[model samples]
Target: MQLEITGHHLEVTESMSNYIREKAERLKRHFDQVMKIHFILEVEKQRHKAEATFHVNGNHLFADAYADDMYAAIDALTDKLDRQIVKHKEKVKDHHRQEAAQLVAATETTD
Candidate 1:
């Protein structure tokens, strides 16, 4: 997957980029259909904010976080995205199974 990181008011450092790379790899492990990810970091006074938009298969997932430190915000953002990715995976995998089962049951009852 492709990753793009942009800063709003601060310059992104090598260390921060590496940290985000590691987190993104972890996310890729959870779902392989991830196509692209765009991350935006912003600093306002004392708040550090991190937001990400994930393009997966044909759908998009988004999550944002705020913390006292940029690293902490990134961590929280990853956690939230992880949950959303897992939920999406489940929905994609199970979307048809339930309907197929219901159809089978209805046919059996009619016979």
Candidate 2:
């Protein structure tokens, strides 16, 4: 997966980038099909905001968080994204299971 980090009002340092990358790896563990991820960090007055757009297959998932600290905001953002990805994975799995069950029922009825 590709990761791009952009800063709006704050300069992104090496440590900050590394921190985000490390947190982002947890997302990959949940869903390996992530195609690309774009992270936006902004500082507006006293609020530090972190936003992420995840590209997975044909779907796009977005999550954002705001806190007094940038690191905290990033942590929250990743957590939200992780939940979304897991939910998406579950939906996909259930969809295939439902389809297979319907197919089996149809074959049994015909036999």
* Overall lDDT per candidate, in order of appearance: 0.97, 0.95
| Residues 1-111 of candidate 1: C-alpha lDDT, one tens digit per residue | 899999999999999999999999999998999999999999999999999999999899999999999999999999999999999998889668889999999999999
| Full-model lDDT, candidate 1 | 0.97
Please give each candidate's TM-score.
Answer: 0.86, 0.86
Task: State the lDDT at 41 in candidate 1.
Answer: 96
lDDT of 2 by residue, 5-89 (tens): 9999889999999999999899999989989999999999999999999999969999999999999999999999999999999
76 Cα displacement, candidate 2 (Å): 0.5
lDDT of 2 at 60: 96
Please give the distance, in angstroms, between residue 36's alpha carbon in candidate 2 and its true position after superposition.
0.3
| Candidate 2 accuracy as TM-score | 0.86
